[model samples]
Target: MKLDFTLKRFPINGRLKEQSGLPFSCVLQPYHRLPEKETSAGDASGTRSNSIARCAQCYSYINCYCVFDTAGWVCSLCNRHNALKPQQQKRYRLDPTVLQELPEVRSEVFETLAEDPIPVPMPALEGSPAAQQDPGYVSGPAPVVVALVDTAAGEEFLELVRSSLEAALEALPPVTRFALITMSNRLGLHDVRASEPSVRYVSLLEPQLRPGASAAAAAASSPAVACPLSDVMPLSSLLAPVGSFKGAITRALEENMVPEQGFGETSDAEASGSGAAVGPSGAPGQEAAMSRNSGGDAAPGGGVGARSGRSGGGHLPAARGLGPALVAVLDYLKVLQSPAFASVKTPDSEGGLSGHGSGASAAAVVGADHLSQNPSPVKLLLFLAGVPDFGVGRLV
Candidate 1:
């Protein structure tokens, strides 16, 4: 392939993203080489593309030819109008002409990421949990809820979880947003997005080596390919208000949520019996195996998910993947909070992104005045009776 070619010189004239005949290649490459006078990538001409606004619909780089008004900017490519982010509105406040100061607007050529601070990529976890299988997970941004459940807790504990979540439902305003995670031997995530309840289980235990397979091969053979958390589920599917999800959330906990049976020092017979009863996803290549169990709790006194007499000294369940589970919950919230994605409308504001529904609304009303001067966008209300014993931060 001819990698190097004549580059479009910057500071030219009229251009639009729709001007396809224009040599985007030349504009993207800029020149055969950096100028000798250049000191660093930061100092290069056309490098300020980072701050250059983009058409949210077409995602085309903003160019000089596009029309910008106080309300929004028209996409040069698709003729779509996209609202300006808060900071972009500031530029419009100063002078619309300032928008042209961007290198892409002046160059009449395509910009490139050849220089700029590339954000460090997040480390891969596993095939995204159950939420990702559905195609419409992030169709658009919305609110989110991650119910972190300790599956090892007994019936009383589960009753508390049920009652608490039910109460949370009553207190929460309507919008379809929720995900329940049951942590025990594996991390079980509920598909609260749907009307029919289901939980996708992921074993935290390291996969046993397959006979006659190399370590490298074993690692590569995982059934689910690792992807960024954002791609794990659809934003539209992930978020919606509480009122829409009250029934489904309640049903999910009652019908689908259950503790993994073989946690800690259970007898071999019990492990075998329970494993036979509950069905596992058994997806190869991943350390986690998805399980969905319907059997009643076997722990003495009929506790929800806990074993009454664990041989282990620790009071905590050995199988609860609390650490990694918490990480996943936070990541979900963080993704929703991001402005680049998860754009949501609030009751107070017609446009903009919201990380939490009720919380966001509360903040808008009394967060600053009554709550805290510096209110946190995401507040994690975790329900755990014990520490984690599996995956990233296993205490045992």
Candidate 2:
């Protein structure tokens, strides 16, 4: 035969959803080991260009935002944990080194809340039962699962979440167990309740491994009765019905717990634009500062370690009745909206959520009345940190 040319065409789904935008994990695959001579040439630069290519700054799972060459993805919890910087590191002075040295801590619930939280208790809903004695409908409490999404880049993102969680827990009654879920694409659920006190090991729940899990569970985790904190998990999708979730969450609080008077409006100096107003310095259980600051890149490590490696953090607890909690977190992102509104930004607009038929106009459906119905009050607390700069206090 003179010549043979065969072309295999890759299939294109041809389904056009949304138009252009700016953007954009590999774990394992079969590969032939290169000879020592080839490896030596690759290592000659001494830039650690050989081992494995990873970001200098790594998260707990696969990196969602890989802009920083120094950044790598770990798990969502670790992503939030790693979002903290050196200056902000003081807030969580738990001594990770010491924690790492401790033996595994079993299912002991530790209340991180302050002895007395800021006392602005909202009026409780009238007539709601303290405990539901009903059958199938009431399954103890919805499992608690919290998912911390990245509002912006920087270590502060993680610190903000940690501070918020500590403050929230301090406000709640003591619990026996908890779990933590952080997600971008890949979901990681670390069972904090399962760990033996002193030892640090996360029981990872990977989505790929278990495809049957609900988006909420995959995004967050099951809200078992024991771990109340697990209620905060990733939402079904950014565009799902956040208000419905909020309503359910609010009902849960009114029935089972009391709303704490935690944070208040910020004064001009303190309210200089960041989400939360800057509270007094050294206020126990309070985040020292709030700013729109970004994070810096960690120094690079040899190839893959920096790019793909786990970030460290303990497991979080699961909470009872978390469906609404998941909804509240989803709503905070300002992505979900009713179908009635038209598009706000252009189809190709990069500012807000895309992929939906409507663009910026999509946000119009997220009205205050909708948020008022939110079942979970805790989500509102979380949304306070992520909402855009506006009169948020008035809106709440």
Per-residue C-alpha lDDT of model 2 across residues 252-309, encoded as one tens digit per residue? 2222111111112222222222222322222112111111121211111111111111
- For model 1, how does the per-residue alpha-carbon lDDT over 225-278 read when each residue is reduced to its tens digit? 123233333333334335445566677677555444444354433232222222
Off by over 4 Å in 1: 1-143, 205-236, 263-318, 340-376
Give stretches of model 2 more than 4 Å off.
1-147, 176-179, 196-396
TM-scores, in order shown?
A: 0.41, 0.20
Backbone clash pairs in model 1 (N, Cα, C under 3 Å; residues 3+ apart or in different chains), count = 22
Model 2 TM-score, all chains together:
0.20
* C-alpha RMSD by candidate, in order: 18.7, 29.5
Please state the error at residue 46 of candidate 2 in Å: 83
Candidate 2 local Cα displacement, residue 19, angstroms = 41
